[model samples]
Structures are given as structure tokens and as C-alpha cells.
Target: MNLIFHVRSERRVTFHPYSSLNDYIDHACCFHCRDGDWWLAKSLLTGDEGFIPCTFVAKAHSLEVERWFFKDLSRRETERLLVAPANKPGSFLIRESETTKGALSLSIRDLVAEEGDVVKHYKIRCLDNGGYYISPSITFSTLQELVKYYTRTADGLCQRLNAPCKAMLPQQPWAQDEWEIPRSTLKMMERLGAGQFGEVWMGYYKGRQKVAIKTLKEGTMEPAAFLQEANLMKKLKHDRLVHLHAVVTMEPILIVTEFMCNGCLLDFLKTEEGRKLKIPKLIDMSGQVAEGMAYIEGKNYIHRDLRAANILVNEMLHCKIADFGLARIIETEYKAQEGAKFPIKWTAPEAINYGTFTIKSDVWSFGILLTEIVTYGRIPYPGMTNPEVIRQLDQFYRMPCPEGCPEQLYDLMMGCWKEKPEERPTFEHLQHTLNDFFIATEGAYEMQP
Candidate 1:
């Protein structure tokens, strides 16, 4: 079938004869090419013909294209999104049922709901005849049709579907060539660290350029799964993120990335030089991480593990987010395996209690990271055992501001630790806030001199 796809982002054809055509007609729909990542398409506005990257578009008719369709969204996440201060009573979205396979659920925000229950969900049933319905008497041929009907009249629903839950436009993956590197070109050097899966070593790419090579231990993880990390890294290209250079999938699988000479942020912060850095410099470091996370969030990806230990620092004190083994695409459902060990103090309550992870959970971890930053790498909730930390969190207890931490910075951290996930500021918001704070603090320090 010749499936239709819509361009989610504008792409400027900078090279070749196609550059002569109009800059990729905005909001254009196109057909996929038989081979490669190119698409054979015409602009919906100007009918201009050109080739576009397949990664720049999304399936036209897929539910994922709709802002309100949040596939695999958990019940708690839906509640949090709908209860946000900006949403109105009739805002709604459709998500795959968490309890039922091959089934969908409709969640709506209701102004009249009791105090504790502002969002309500209803099961959407599908018939063997390929029709969908929330009530037996209101079957529709497509989900779009059902939504259209509800938009005009509440009928059996709690309220009319006035608007889709606010969300960013979908982001497609990057189109790139194979990244496999010849094993003969690399010269392994000193070991950096060891983990449960494998060890990381300092290596030289092409015998001169520095790089970090992460090797996969045999029988530790499936090769395909390990390669998936490399594939994910390919799409995440940002200056503040550890850049992936190449991979060796041969006998000993290796992932090569840009080397951070200073090593992980946690260890660096505890060093004598690290402790001597002023608060403004620490804020600048934290802002760099926020900037990287903002990019990841915009692309609809979640870094499930966001802690100081996972951040790497360069010789210049610049920080970058590293370690993607626990990252996931927002659209996919993720559940922690039972009995699996998690970083209790660094994890959010919902994730620890129910195995649900979302971008909000990452925000919670960032709050804990702030405590580490101000204390020069002190552990979060020190003197408390894991079980004790959980018990305190259940009582709504939060970590206090570290000594010498600025009042404004502590307040921002508290905002990140809000009990409701929706109340946490997004990475983009946090980035802007921290950037502004850094500038103000730097100015104050200069004035004192």
C-alpha cells in the first residue's frame, strides 16, 4: 500500500539540483520512495516536487499524528496532563488501554468531577466489523469520526471534546548513513570504569583522536538490544550530549563516543578543584545539562535515568548527558521488571511504587541532582536508608536546601519535587530559568570585584 505521510518539520534542501525547488512546501504530504530514506513528494500548498528525508515525516493517518492520541500513556500520566492549570474541562485524549490488549481508552477532563477525580476514562470497544464505539448505540467507522461527533455533542460523554490535550508536534528520527567502524582502526588504552554489563576504556580513534569505548560483555545482553543503544544515540545529536562517533558490532561489540576527559560529573564534583568552584559556575554546569535534556524532551524521548553520576564533565568543566541504556521513546510503554533494582533515592515515587516512568519522573530525579550539585556531590537524603527514604517520601517529605545553596535555586528544586508530576517544570522551562539565573549571578560577582 502507498501510505501517505505528512512532513512534521520543514527541511531545506541545501544540496543538489533539488535545491532549486521551493523549500519543502510547509505541511506537505508525500509518498515514500521504494528505497533509501528519501521520499517522493509534492507540496500540499504549491505542488512543488522534491525529495525529503523520510525521518522528517510521520504516517499521515496514524493516531500518533493526532495531538490528542497518546499511545501507551499511563492512567496517572493522563491525569497529570489533564489536570494541568492550562487545560479546560472538555480537553480530551485517547490512549491505548493499560489493562486491555488491542483496546483503547478515552480520558476527559471534567470540571464537575469530585476533588480527587478530575479526569475520567471510558473504554473504547472495537467490533469485528472494524467499527469503534464507546457506547453500543454510537458506533463509528473510524476514530476520527467518533471524535468529530463528540466535538459537536457530548451525547453519552461527560462533556464535549473541545480541544486536544496540549502537546508538541511529533519529531521523527534523523536520516543517516551506517556508523559501523573498522575494528582495526581503534587502539584501546586505559580503562575508565566497569559496570554490570561491561567496562569502559579510553581509546584512540584512528590512532590520534580521543574517544571512549564501551564494550559489551558476552552473554550480558543481546547484541540487537545493545545495538539499539547505538541506534538511539545516532538520532540524539546535540553539543551538550555525548556525541556518538562509531560502533563495532563484531566479536566484541563497542560503542565509541566523544571523550569527556574529566570523567563523570559525580566524581569530578567531589574533587578538590571541583569543590573550589563558585556557585555561579555550578549553576552554569547544571544549565548545560538542562539544555541537553530540553533537546531530548523536544524530540519526544525520555532519559529515564537522570542523575549526577550519569552526567560527564569535560576538562573545561562543561557537562553533557551520557548513558542511554535506560532511555525510551515517549510513545512506547515501559514497565520495570518485578524485583529489578532501581535507584530508590534518585527515582520518582510513581516509578518506585508502580513502575510507571514519564518525562515528569525525570524532572523528579533532576531535583535530587540539584541537591548533589549544591553540596559538591553529597549523596541525596544522606543518613537515610532506601526504605526510610521511601517512607519519608510517602509522607510528602522533601529534601531540605543544602547549606550555602541560594534561596532561588532551592525554590526551583522544590518546584521539581512537587508530588504531582504535572506540576514539575519541563526541561525547556528549567533551561531558560537556569540560564537567566546564571547571567544574573555572574553579573553580581563581577560587580563585587
Candidate 2:
């Protein structure tokens, strides 16, 4: 027989160019040749991005990489390299730009690297279902050459490369809307784990720095909620608050971002390995947290749920507060009116008793947090529930921060813990006070956590 046929898919059939068609399985770079009855196709459509080519070789192979080639990147062409559904540590890619035709070129690698300096090599993982990563060399010379070579290349080459070779999509916003992602981006979402909401994941935004995609978690909440928060967060520019990357509406949800790998402060503080909270680190992080809150407070934002869990810690042990889920503007008494429950001990006595919340209420909460720092995360009243904590608040229960913990911290905590709430220091005052205290202690205090 000249051809093999699926009795059902009898639509069309072609015979093999060679016997068995699978003999050269172990041969590397098999697709460029015709012997294997399979080939590597270049599609800008896959989640792996046009950063790498798709190897359709070794047909009938169960390896996820093999099946991926047959898929399409044409769907959701607007986003090529996804960032959400963050692939496994190893499942993604980055571009290897080289000089071709007196221009730079890029090749995908199997790892997202740590080095992105001019001479360093980097690997980036794809956010889609394709478990692919590109190990790219970060060479300034090569990157420059590629830019010179491809007049169309922008340092900010995003999903636009998948633009049809024939120029099928026009430049207008509406035209770009109907555009289909190229072959490379087609299979990007395949096998990708579902993201928080409709967020699509990608890497290398702004400066190719490692960052994370904040998407809406699927459930009863509308993806719009995430977008709303993302928008609000994007406008918030503070060194201490989590930096917002972009507020993109990927139809189903919005995306918020901050540097990747910097998990929340709770996870960070709990880790005992290779961690040293020099007084500087503590003061810096705590100070930043306070500064961030000050900024939010100026905008009338009340981070109703301020705690270690919402604050992120970078590699430098620098702190940046996040998670505005329970955050709100102080103009209204929304949650208070709804009788929504929140962390009890963290609540100001007024918020709990009088059902009133304001900037001062946030100040009171920060006081408890300052105490949490000295106590290393032990809640003020460890064994009490919200109702029980409320009882304690009524009695003006306060935790006596341990000795050997910085005395200035003790002073700050006590001031913020005042039951009257009016006695709590404002965020700005807290910042300046801490700064002065630290400068004076710089030459003194052993600086222990």
C-alpha cells in the first residue's frame, strides 16, 4: 500500500518516506532531515514563544514535548509567552539572541538562568503547557547585533513577533484584536495549570527581571475584582509596597505583579536557613512597611489585613507589603457596616468596639505588627480567638515585648498599642522616629533580631 489510513480520518493520507519512520529516535536535530517522517516546525504560536522551534520529530512519542509540536499557538495570539500557570521550575524558555545577517538572533534554552548581566547567560521558562525553557546567553554585543540586523526587532519584543509573515494582521487596535498568535505561541497555554483567574503568565517584563503574575483565583469572585485591584496597585508607587508590573485585562481577569521568588514575609521569616536579620535588615524592612502604609494611608487606603503574610521579602531580606484583598479606602464604612470579620487582635479597639475604622485604626494595627516583629511573629494574645481577642482588647491587653529586643522598638510598640487609638503615632511620625533611633543606634546596639 502506498499509504496508511485511519478508516475514519480517510479524508487524506500520505505514505512514509522511509520504513518504520522511527528508526532515528536517538539522533539529535532529526527534524532538519527527512529520514524520520517528522520535522521541527517554527511557530511563534507556542507558549514557548518563537524563542525556540517546535521539534515534531519522534511521532507517537509520549514525552510532553513531542505532543506539544502538533498543537497550535494561534489561540489567544495577543499573549505569546505566558506568565501565569507558572510552569514547573524547569518548564519554560528565554531567548538566545545572536548576530545573524549582521543582526541579533535568539534561541530558546531549557532553563531560566540567574545571570542577566551583559556577558551572562540566562534561561527562561514558558508559562504555557509546553514544558519548555530557553537557556539564552546574555551578551550585550550579540543582542545589539540582532537589533541592528532585524530592523523590526524592538528590545521590548513581546508577542508581536508571531505577527503573520504575510502581514495578515493590520496595525490598527481593532485589527490587532482579530490577530491570531503565530504557530510558536499556539500551544502556549496547553498543559498550563489553571491560573488564579484569567491571568496569562510571561517572564521578562520591564527589564527582563524575574517577576510573578498575579491573577484572579477562580471561584465565585469575578475576574474583574483582580483587575480592579491590579489597576489600583499599578498606580501605587512606593518602595515598600509590592511594585505593580502591569494591569492587563486578559478577558477573564487582570494581572498584578512583583519580583518573582520573593514570597510573602511569613514564608520568609519562617525560614531559618542562611537568614540573618541584622538590625539594618529589620529596620529597613519594618521601616519600608511603615512607609508603604503611610503612602497607602495618604491615599486613604486601609490595608485592613496587614500582617506578615501580606508582606513580601526579597533576596536582600528587604520587605515590600502586598495583598490588598482586604484593603479598602477609608472614605466608607463598608466592611464595618457589613460586619465582615477580620483578624481580631490586629484590629484597633475602636474598630472592634465602636465599629469605626480609619487611618488611626490602621496605625493601631501597625503597632501590633511592630510588636509581632520583636516577638518573632507571636500574636499579641496567642491563645485567643477573635471574640476572645476582642475581650482582651476591651481589657487593653498588651504583650510585653521581650528584653534584649531593641528598646526603641519597645517604645514604638507601646505608643501604637495605646487603647485610645488617638495616642498611636501617625505613619510619618513613626518613620522619622525610627530613622532617628536607628541612626543613633548605628554605632551602638549590637543589632540583634
In terms of lDDT, the best-performing candidate is 1
* After superposition, candidate 2 runs with Cα above 4 Å error: 1-209, 223-229, 247-254, 273-275, 332-339, 441-449
lDDT of 2 by residue, 1-449 (tens): 11111111111112122211221222222233222223322212221101111232333333222211222332111011221122221222222223222221121112223311011122223323433222232222332233232234323332112211110111111111322212221212122124233343434333323345444544625546655664565567675777665444544333435553546665565567213334434555677688788888788777777877667765544567776656665575534756566677777888777777777888888877776665555656777677877777677777766645677787887888777767778898887776455445333211110
lDDT (Cα, tens digit) per residue for candidate 1, span 263-372: 99898889997776667567767887899999988888888889998899865566889988678676754677788677999999999999988888889999899889
- What TM value does model 2 have? 0.51
Report the alpha-carbon TM-score of model 1 versus the true structure.
0.58
Model 1: CA > 4 A from native: 1-178, 438-449
Best by TM-score: 1
Which residue pairs show backbone clashes in model 1? none
